[model samples]
Target: MASDGSPSRDTPEKQKRKKKQKQRVEDDEEGRSSDGAEVRLDDDDDDDADEEKRLEKFAEEDIQRLTAAGHAALQSGDNHAAVKHFRSAYSYASKLGTRRVSKTCALNLGAAYVEAGNAEKGLRVLQRQGSSGRVADLQFNLGTALEALADAMEFEEAVRSLLRAGESYSSSGNPTEAALALRDAGKVMLQCGRDSSEEILNVLTNSLELSMRITHSETRGRILNTLGLLFSQMSLSSEAVECFQQALPLLSGNTQTLAVVLQNLGATHNTLGEFQKALSYHKEAAQLYGSLGRRAAQGRCFSNLGFALMELAEIEEARESYTHSLLAFKDSVCEALGAIRLQMREPEKAVVHFQEALGLLSRCQDVSSSVQERLVNKLSEALQHKLILQQRKAVAQRRHSQRLPGAAMRRPDVLIGRREMMNSGGNTHDRNQVSTEFHSEEPEKEDYSNTLPEANRNLNNTHDETDTGQQVISSQPENGPGEPSVECGKQMNGTLPLVSGTVTPPPGRHKATPPQRTLKSRFCTVM
Candidate 1:
């Protein structure tokens, strides 16, 4: 009778009560029907004549007060007042309320609360009405509120709210709102990438479609930019270029927006290995930003140009660009970061960048828990990279230190390491099996031949034995290509380091450089 050894509460009376509760829940979810509030002509109870007449008189008076005052208060931006009067509406409507008035009043009241900076209260009121199509709008409001609270507290529930909003918005003939929600969701999905590119293209595509249809040119431009950004994520530079072009013209009077677009387009091109195009875009962006007095944007463009130059193997030019960007965006966290990273491609530099970003965000009075957490993660990644680099550096230094004394007496900077030999040694490769069919004996061409230039001839004739292992003479330039006819200057295999730099001790053994501070910024700019 009782699963917990308590008296059974499963009687018919209990069942009826439970059923009523369930129905109540369903009703609360679906909102109250105006039909129940309406007076039915079929229910003409003669005993209620006196009461009905009195009720009609009171309701008529109440409706007048509710209607006049509520409208006036709403116009005056007194949302709380508006809601108070709107709540009295049910008492005033003798024949019950119309669906349009009831639903619209509730929605408008909730919206007023939101506009008045009472999101939590608004959400509460909105959620009181179960499964109305307005849930989507409520969800959007909830997401914004949660994002605002993210700095002070964790709003992990924002995702569920966002999903609900998306569903409702999609179902309510407002595809644009749904698309926007999907765009937000895609950001989360893309960050989910581990090995391959994240599968956020579907969400982005939907956003792109809806955004394109928006009537506002500025908003339309932003959506087009979103497409460009999505394409950039996939390293599809050409497609990104097309999107950017469409957006740039639309965003044309807004200097700051235009500069940012150019900068993004420039960065995308660089990533795609299009240095020439990247250069032109960056230069234009930098100039525009400079004219607009937007130092941060100007500096960012400069840094992007440096990265492009670095890819082209123009080390000196890259360094100059980075230095300029750092100076221009001196107050900017990313600028300092760009400088540090350009110096050595060090993760420590990344840490500095993140820290700077965090600091800047804080200074702007926008410190949030999410920003702090992201910065912390970036710092951790930087530290790990720094540790790995330190380990590598220590190993190289140790080897160099051991050879310091013999430097004058032996070859310079020779690499020393114990190597393992697999199976029977003579560097055997099972030549016949690893190659295409070779003539059994048509005066078999020697593997080592005159085809290789004379520069390697001397190297082939020499060999050295070391305690570590048998050292073979390397018959090629250490930093040059192995191709026999390669231009010595060209270093055919591109084996040499792109930049020329002598390893020097770090500024200080335990210098505390700025840590990277990854703050959430302009994430919705493109979206």
Candidate 2:
């Protein structure tokens, strides 16, 4: 009876169907071999086939699910979860004898492992799948894994893999990926500290060509910026300038990247000796950095700006720029400010700044000893310069006090009389020649210390000089102890020749040159 009180429905129709089914099962079980053992029938064979198909369908579904989950995790930056999921998917796909699906799964798994920083495991998994051939994705992931595992010795292999991957990607019509792969190859070469060899140039050129075809402006800009940095490092200033300039407009929407491009342009122009262009670009970069609230970067920009300003002989503006830099970050700017003071012949002030820089540097971590030694040398030079200036000033003061007031009033007439005497010989000698001859005939015992005050005045008034006549102070290597000093009388285009060592004027000459100025190399830091 039914539980709901309905009439029972197990009639003859159901009984007949059950009997037929039982008969068929018994017949299938009745089949036997020669040893009288039961054998399977067609009906049982059909059932077993359906069950296998069902299990296979379930496995395929699981693979699809896991693969989707892996991709999602990878995109979300959950590398470990992506690796686990992809690994399971790859295992299932492998057992299912689906060669194409399994290859895809393997590539995904390998990429996930690489992103997780397990490059060794990624490499093993990728290699285990056999030859990748012309498969772009497979080749790219393989290259990435190889590069991640590369050391100094294996860099060549990594570069080769990346180049191959780039070619494969290009052939597959993926210009963006191709450009990225080539750029990676270039970076690997740079990391190995390779010279600007033909191979490196070719790789970077190919990357630039590929990047040109990309529609994404920021990506292209970034690639150009990277190439510019590489060229700059290799001393290819012209090429670097071109690359940075091209990247500038493309990166405008991104302030940080735009600032970097501007800064790089400024540095490259500075290297090319285009101070005007450098000044403009550095000013723009500094402004951008200020807007971004990046004090360190802003300070560096201001420092570079000060360098350009100094080159333009804008002494006051340069000093102001250095002051801004010092306010932004106190350490590195101290050294630069000290260099400026030294150039201005304010050695006392230079000494103080250099000492402060040295003290700050000592407190910094991971600072190289050579840097500190350089600072020490600069400090020593500043102190020596200060002492020399003081001694010269004292001697000039004493001689000034000893001289009669009427002697200064009569000096110009005495010089004119000597020039007239020289001209009386009917040889129209210039004033310079007359002065030279007059001094040559003077008594050898006569003291030439009378010209010291004039020379001192020239040194003090150097800041008023024009760009064409101004001295450039840098941080370049000083002359050796035995090197001959530059002659101050050898002027070019109304500009005093650069002095490479101590200045020593000829007797009775009032003209003097400023102290030797060094040339420091400036480099732009890539962010």
Candidate 3:
């Protein structure tokens, strides 16, 4: 202070100048503090903007990854893994702020929950999502899940679940399922004293129109085929035929579906009693099934065709067709029976087919007592036919044995005593092999011309010599009244029995009567 009084090193002017400089330094420090605060605030705002963009990018990537994982898990048939990813996706979408993404994730999560047997949780999630907006697919799945759990619910509630399921499926691009659901609905609705045809038609129409919007030909064909079946059941044959035809054109490109359509067409034709046309359709169906590599389906088609042909009196053809069917449908007794019926034309083979069919049908515990009765009756009839055929063959063989060149007199195939001999009550000749033939010899070398009875030589060749197991078809002296003038040589070539024979059948033998039309077989819905 004393030095400053004299302004030690300076006067008052120097001291004032130092104070002013100090004040200037203080002011600059204050300005720096304010400017630094403003700059820092601006920088913080820029960082926040950049961080928001990066968060959005990260959120999008998370969603995409979650979706991919969920889909992969589904493809691997791991429902639990899919559920985890779906849940993660839901959480990520919620945080990321996209309502659409969040809803879809929740829907997938619900489906996974259902697949995991967590039905209640899935229902809650789905209901919540549905309340917020609409997702036809999600609703359909939930309703279907609910329907499958009907046993756990009240009867009324279970029925309602089915009803809802039908509605949901209809709106979800699943027309076939929708129609089936509708059919079930109709059955249920009938219990309430209501006809569901009108309602069913409405659903059916909508389903058809909706199916046209999709690109999956298989799905569309299935829907169309289902509609055809449904309509057929309703007795709308024409409509059903149209639907099946529509499906046919589309399904022709797919072997499996084409076979199905052909089968449906055959069924419709059969219902209309267009037997020939039905056989044609069924034959085509069988071929189509073969092309599609379905042995069972081919067998079924052939069986149906055989049944149709039999009714049309094409027994020989029916037998061949049934034989073809039996080769493929080895497990089905019905198919075996069909083959047996075919063999009915050649009664010799009937017994074998009938016995095989009976053995198989016996194994099926689900077979109804009525079906068993029918099978037994058919088997009995086939056995009876076999017996008659055996008896006829035996009688014919005995007569043939008697007719040879120098054999003893027994029954003659050609009854000379009667244009109507007392044949009606006559018994068949007993088979006798007491080889008795008289041969004439030459007289003192003045031999007769050598015309060694050709018939005798042939008989000798048949009865005694050949090492080969070749069969002999000799003249069975029974060529009917208008016998052809062929010699014994052509007799080796067996001729078909003449239907216009005046040859009377034996007393108790069943004759070839016309086909017996069934009076009242149990009726089917014929759908």
Best by TM-score: 2
**Per-model RMSD to reference:** 28.2, 28.0, 29.8
Off by over 4 Å in 2: 1-54, 193-196, 330-527
What is the Cα-based lDDT of residue 90 in candidate 2? 83
Over the stretch 90-203, how does candidate 3's per-residue lDDT look in tens digits?
A: 898889787777777777777677666676777677768754333444534455445434443422343454456557656665555454444334333322323466875665
Candidate 3 lDDT score at position 129: 72
- TM, every model: 0.42, 0.54, 0.49
Q: Judge candidate 2 against the unseen true structure and give its global Cα lDDT, from 0 to 1.
A: 0.63
Reference-based lDDT, each prediction: 0.50, 0.63, 0.51
Candidate 2, residue 179: lDDT: 80
Report the lDDT tens digits of candidate 1 across residue range 1-527: 68889887688989998987877777677785434324354345544886777876666567556756765665565657866775566334425444444444454455445545665765665556455545665565555444434333424455456657767767777766666665554443443342234345656666667666666676567556655655654555577678788888888876656765776677666655677888888888878755654444455567777777777888898888776665544434463353356235577776677567666545432123433454455556456556656656765875786668776554433332222222332233443232223233225633212211111221222122122100110111111100011111111111110111111111221224333211111101000
Residues 1-527, candidate 2, lDDT per residue (tens digit)? 79999988878999998887777777668763333223346667789999989988988899888988876665565779978998898899889887777777787787778778898888788777776433666666666677677667666776777788789879889787788778767767866765356877888889889988989887678777766765654556688788888988998897777877787677667767788988888888888766654444555567778877888889999988776665555544576677668767799998998799777765543334544665677788678668667756754764665486786777777668647766774454453464465457446533224222112222322234344212211111212111111112212222222222222221122233324322111001101
Choose 2 or 3, whichever is better by lDDT. 2
In angstroms, the error of model 3 at 492 is: 51
Task: Supply the TM-score for candidate 2.
Answer: 0.54
In model 2, which range of ten residues has the least summed lDDT? 518-527
